[model samples]
Target: MFLRRAVYYWQLIAALLLPLWLFVGWGIWGGGAWTFVGVVVAAPVLFIAILVVTLIIYGRSEVRAANAVSWLDVALLALWHLSIIGLGCFGATGSLFAMLTVVTGLAAFWGTLWQLVRGFTRRARQTLREFEQLAGQTPPRGHVSSPEQGDVYVVYESRDQRRA
Candidate 1:
């Protein structure tokens, strides 16, 4: 439980810090000068994707209520983040690993979105069921759903009175 909450928070901060790490890591151990060009493209996109995944997951009411990410979210995030870190290092071919990261990031997006849609649909179904139950309920012996059952008095005053 604590780990899930921590992961949720980390996902938020990762949006900024991970991309920065990619830039700094590459600058230090970059294969060549051309790597910076890739960083220029990948870093911003990575940043955006991180935020998007975080937001999509957070959009789930269950996550917000629990203040934690699901196991699936943690798994997808671990893959995506580790891949991003892999992108920073030059041990493997930069382009190859970068492509891997891109694919994983895309997967994360799709995964989070899928969960969001499913949660929303489930909640909507529950709400419709509740509405049906409510509609089936009969009112008590005396009920006043009509407005005329109650009387109201309006108090109107000139706006100029307050100005004085």
Candidate 2:
């Protein structure tokens, strides 16, 4: 279990770092610092953004408690895992590897956003329901009235009505 988490983050970090390394290595070979900054730094920054988004989603899931992970969260986690394989196999082709990384990262990004939106919307709805119920109470003004079956209801005009 612990190993899985380590591997997941390792893959994400590698996905970010490896592209930068390749770009910088190529730029050094070709004697162009501009390419190094434009390609190297940009690629990793984009990848790291994805990592941040995934962490946000995971953090929200943790906050929402057990079983709060939605299908989107699961899908993002799966994509994060798959990025390792994609990176390992296609790392030689920088463009293709970067594209794969971006695609997987986008999944993570949207997944987190979806989870957060869902969590907030759910909380808001719950609060609204509570407020509506409170507003609907008999004494809706200053104080809440406890439910008293006998005192709250009286048979005003029934054939079987009797004085208490």
Every candidate's lDDT: 0.85, 0.58
Q: For candidate 1, write residues 46-145 as lDDT tens digits.
A: 8888888889998999999999999989888998888888778877576777788888888899999999999999999999999989888845534545
What are the runs in model 1 whose C-alpha is more than 4 Å off? 139-164
Q: What is the C-alpha RMSD of each candidate to the true structure, in Å?
A: 7.4, 10.3
Weakest ten-residue segment in model 1 by summed lDDT: 149-158
Error of 1 at 125 (Å): 0.6
Clash pairs detected, candidate 2: none
TM-score, each model? 0.81, 0.53
lDDT of 2: 0.58
